[model samples]
Target chain A: MRIAVDLLGGDDAPAVVVDGALRAVRADPDLNLLLVGPSEAADAVIAALDPVDRARITVRPVRDAVRMSDHPSAAREASTVRDAVAAVRDGTADAMVSAGSTGATVTAAALGLGRWPTIRNPALVATLPAVGGPVVLLDVGGSLEPRAGILARHAVLGAAYAAVAHAIDAPRVGLLSVGTEAGKGDRARRTADPVLAAEPLPCNARYVGLVEGYDVSSGARADVVVTDGFTGNVLLKAVEGAYAMAGGPPAGGGVPRAAALLGVSGTVVVCHGAAVAADVASGIALAAHLWRHRATDQMAALLAGHAWKGHDHIIDTEVTTP
Target chain B: MRIAVDLLGGDDAPAVVVDGALRAVRADPDLNLLLVGPSEAADAVIAALDPVDRARITVRPVRDAVRMSDHPSAAREASTVRDAVAAVRDGTADAMVSAGSTGATVTAAALGLGRWPTIRNPALVATLPAVGGPVVLLDVGGSLEPRAGILARHAVLGAAYAAVAHAIDAPRVGLLSVGTEAGKGDRARRTADPVLAAEPLPCNARYVGLVEGYDVSSGARADVVVTDGFTGNVLLKAVEGAYAMAGGPPAGGGVPRAAALLGVSGTVVVCHGAAVAADVASGIALAAHLWRHRATDQMAALLAGHAWKGHDHIIDTEVTTP
Candidate 1:
């Protein structure tokens, strides 16, 4: 399987991205790369590779790619990121990776790969390696509102993602709130609590009502934690910050730099804009892993199976707007 | 100054309450207590204390109080918390402490003491020890919206409270959001960010623009961080959880249990629902500190000074809803 890399993304541009690409290529012998960027960036990777290994690499040289400061729409269609998506859209590559602006990567993917049925907002799924395996959190930086309907959609997405990607049999879904009590949260939460209860979840997932901030780290209440992007982003960082305050993360666990962008059709990964070389390398590995497992396709199929009957509006509009 | 404490508050009621009360009395030699609950509870406290120290303690027998399982409105006209408020209302006590329920304490204080003119929702202000000094966070569990006008008013309330309570000279206020960048937040935050920027802060405070959750722990950006109650409550707990995960807090810092209820006409302190003996004692100490320093009165007087200008509606509505 071939994976495309956006060389012009992230704070540390082509140099770190180039270094990360070299690392990822060496780590996974089965990995074939489509270095999508300017000539110098693609040449940098080629020069560092042995002749035998260089044969496994392909270059799709574009003059430019989506810069972190560029508008998502202004990213040239022929740039590495957009062209990388086109490669997947044309089935030339199995998956793609980017460390660009989250908004831009998301925009390119949602526009190029298309979205699942009834999925208006695309979710940024981050898997935390908790004590109970991987706990999948949705809308990590997507959909930043607490409308019951939005949360309910995320519930289905999280459940399907868990079943397909992590191979969890039955996921327990929990809505993040201040307390576990029925009426424990603010007005939006009070309104969403019952709505989340009534909504149907995929993969035989159970709704555990309300859970607190601790659950994110411990993963005690639910395998699937659903929240709006606003809360999720703040919460994810806060947890990372807490880990920092605690000196570091719990043993065998730490904040993830790479997040899988689900809902858009192809296998795609978005690394943090502040990511380092190791982070970008891990992101590439994650994309390759997802592609190997056919995680995106399987998850998409799972969601299709549990797709809501009449709420096709979500699917038709925007899938990964977060 | 004398303080009245609800004897039947919190999940671990009566016992924890009794233990906490005993600890508080022992810690503060100048403290006088009015234990408002059952006569048996009051007698139990009286029994625990030495006869000599018991001279400083008093009891007011009242059976009614809001239970965690009960509706908050139960603390309306008749209850132990109401009586405690009444004690302060009638000059029987200088201040009060409760760990029973936030809604109940807020309601009791608002009705018993009456809201300060122009303040609709009274804010719960928690002071976190940051690297810089003390950072005051308001609306920990009060309001949960992103109204620009409310946030503006909260800036004023936070500024005065920081000065009067924390003794900070020129408090810097900030709007809590996902990112520090100008437009790095949700819709509500986007609207409130500029509003907070344009509003005039009291006590010589200034707006430092948008800040992240790190600012809350580090206290590097602003002295007063304001947000809706929902975000604050979750953020506070997340910080507490982080401290726990980290082994302990920063050398001399930990999560705060005592929060001062501002925007009301009387002096009130609310402890965490899971208050331990030290939490209760610290809460009582906070009450004493506020009263001894006349912090509440000074805050009120400052409001009175700015009553006609800034925001007359907020003056009567909420101390700050930002």
Candidate 2:
């Protein structure tokens, strides 16, 4: 399958992205890339591949790109990210990957692919390799100020994504908080705990009550961990930093620099802005895996079976509550 | 110096507390402990020490304790934690250490010792051993719902703490957020960024703008990282978990099971409720170090020189704002 790659995303754009693109294409003979950026950057990738493998690369040739300093709304402009999303919309590519500003990618994807019904806020789900299994963490940078209902909705998304993406049956979903006990977090967590427990989870998943930060890396408490964008983003980075300080990650793997953009209709992956070439390559590989699994569509179908009534009203009320 | 030990605190109360107290007393020749809990638990510690070392331990019998499930305010009763606070307040001990519910310890300490002027919320500061130096993180579990003013206040606290506790001169203080770029986080961070930048820091410290979670372990961005108690607590635990997953902490040390309680008048140390005997001993050692350095009083004296005028008004307005 073909995946659209944003050539001018990330801190060291073009060079690292091109290098990553080459690595991913060479690693998987069947993987084709729709390079959406300046022709020069795309040609850089094309020149590196052999004549027989060159046909796997196609150029969309968008000139402008959203910079790291640009606002999330800048994706509305004619940029590489926008064009990459457009390629996916037109079926030129099965999925898209960008190592750019997370906000911009999320904005472009939500606007271009359309968010799933009953999901006002999209989630960026990252999987951490734990001893027991993979621990899925969500909202790494999607909705920053999620109310109780939004969190409950994310619980449903995380469970479905875990089941579809990782093939973990009956995933135990836990709300990330300061403590594992009830009423151990700020106002947001205190309100969301009961809401999550009451909400019906898809894929036979069950809410495992409140969990502490230790559970994120240990995976001893839950298979899926749900948190607001702000905490999840910071926690993910902190864990990565800790692994770095400790010399290296466990034998399993380190924190994935790429995260799936859930709640959108199309398959999209957002890599960390500070990602290196290997991280970008992994982002492309993750996109291909998700596309082949049809994980996004499968998750949407699973969510459709679970009715989420009255959540919107509850979220509205909670948001307006001082 | 004498440190009051909360013998009935922690998940595995009495047993671990007694074991920790014995370890602490044996490690420091000049260290003395005032045991506050059931007589049996105190007797166990006294029984373990040699006759010559027995004088280093003093027993204050109090059978009741604030259970993990009890409300933080339960420390108001005649529990071990509350009695430990009384020991500090009455000059029966120079400092106190508790491997107990953080809420109970914070509440008890604040009520017993009185809060420092201009400091409404107490802060629990933890230091992580990074590659370059120690990175001091504040408000680990002291103030959960901190407004912008509280965060700005914490910046000042963290700066002085790094200088006094760790002897890091001119510490670079950074606000923890999702991204390093200006205006990259939620409304709370966006509001607090400028406020922290504007606030004058003690110990020749300066604000380093926003920093990501990686800075917490790498010490690459700032020596002092400030955030609300909720975020700080979770990040600390997550980093600890990461270190555990990576085999062990870096050669320096792992996440400290104990954190220093700031913004209160007396010296207090709060250990993780899941703390083992070694963690309790380290908490005692931390308390002894602070007592020797008079860190609590030094921080208060330093803060007194900095004008915090108009902060309360801004905090009130922001809290009331939608």
Candidate 3:
């Protein structure tokens, strides 16, 4: 499979991204990368590769890269991340990976690839390896405002993604809140709990009312934990910090630095902006895995089959302005 | 110092509470406790203690206990937590500890002990042992909705709390957000950032822009991390879960099960509803330490001296309706 790599995306862009691209090509023989960035950065990756593997590496020269200080809408400009998305849009690459600002990557992908009809806001889903199994958390920097409709829609996306990507059958979906009981959270949680419960879930997923923060790391309560982007983003980082404090992560694994962006038409993976070389490499691998499994198309079909017919009005009324 | 203990508060209440009270009296010879609950539950504590130590324990019989299912307003009734607050109010106990519904405990404490005039919302502060020092996090289940004024006030409470409770000098206070960069979080965080920066802090505290979830556990950025209660609550629990999954906590300590409530007139410590016997014992210890240090009185004086004179209009206009 071919993946477009945004070499000028991370905090240590070009250097780390070049190192990551070299590693990805070496690790997977069948994997090919279309490096999108300045000519020098792409050359850094190609120069390091062995002559035999150079055939698997391609370059799309784009000088301008999105900086962290730039606004998300800056993706509208001709930047590396936008070009990476364009590569996937034009069928030059099967998927794309970026370690730029999450907002910029989301904007570029949503604008370039177009979003799924039913999904108003795209979600960034991160999977944590827990005791029982992997726990899928969604909207981890996508939609910040905690509206009931957004949460419900994300819940659907999460369940389908868990089933398609992770091969979890009949995933147990839970709404992340302060407490596990109904009406246990703030106004948004209280409003979202019932809406999520009433909404029909795809892939035989069942709504498990409300779950607390502990459930996110334990993975004993639910497989798919849905929350607003703000809480999910902070919680994910806090867990990463805790693992570091405890010496290291559990045998299962550490918190993921890369998250799959759902709701966009093409497969996309976003690495943490401060991600290391290994993190970027893993992000490229994630993008390849998703493309190989046809996860995005499968999730789209599943969602289409179980559309929010009963909750269309709520979704329509609560379309948040970015 | 005498502390009022709510015997019928937690999930395994009366039993764990009785055990916890016994441990507290045994550990601190000078400590005295006023047990508020059924006579049998109080007697259970006295029966387990030595004859000499038994004198340190007194009972105020109140059968009605607010269950988790009950509304937080139910604290207005003569429940065990309410009675415990009354004991503190009437000077029978210098402080109070409860392993009950946080909302109910906040309600009982706020109503019986009264609130500080400048602070409109009461904040629950938890201290985590970090690499540098103890990191103080506030509003862990107090105010859920994220109003900029409430967050700004919480930053003040957290800063003073670190200096007074944890003995951190010139505590570096930070507003918790998705990223350390300015304007990187949700609308609430974006609005609160500048307000907190402009607000004058007590105890030589200084605002350190925005810090991420990693700062909360690492304590590398700020001694005090401030956020709305919803985010704080989940972040704390998620950290706890991560530690558990990683085998155990670091040598410094684990996530605190007890949090000190600020903005109330009397010293109050609220434990996790699912607290164990050890957690309850530690909570009682925390309350005793606070009372001995006169933390509540000191914080109130500090807040009063450095009142929100510059931001009074914002505080007055954004008074949340509980």
Pick out the ten consecutive residues of candidate 2 chain B with the lowest summed lDDT: B313-322
- The digit string of per-residue lDDT tens for model 3 on A1-322 reads 8999999998999899999988889999999999999988888888888888888988999999889889888999999999999999999999999999888999999999998877767889999988789999988988888888888988899999999999999999999988887878888889889989889999899999899889988899999999999999999999999999999889989999999999899999999999999999999999999998999999888877876833563356432222
Worst 10 residues of 1 chain B by lDDT: B313-322
Candidate 3 ranges beyond 4 A from true positions:
A309-322, B309-322
Evaluated against the true structure, the overall lDDT of model 2 is 0.88
Ranking by DockQ: 3, 2, 1
Tell me the tens digit of each residue's lDDT in model 2 across B45-102.
9999999999999989998888888888888988889999999999999999998888
Segments of candidate 1 deviating more than 4 angstroms: A43-56, A76-78, A129-133, A307-322, B307-322
Whole-model alpha-carbon lDDT for candidate 3: 0.89
What ranking emerges by lDDT with the best candidate at the front? 3, 2, 1
Q: In candidate 2, list every pair of residues with a backbone clash.
A: none
In model 2, chain B matches the true chain B with a TM-score of 0.96
Q: Put down candidate 1 lDDT per residue, B172-202, tens digits, no spaces.
A: 9998877677877787788778777777777
- Which lDDT tens digits does candidate 1 get at residues A1-322? 8998888888887888899999999999999888888888889999999988998788888876677666667554667788888889998889998988887888888889997766766778888766666788877786777777777788888988888778888899998887788888866677778877877787788889998776776677889888888888777776676666556777756778788988889999998887888988999999998998898888888777774632542434333333
Best by lDDT: 3
Q: List candidate 2 segments past 4 Å from native.
A: A313-322, B313-322
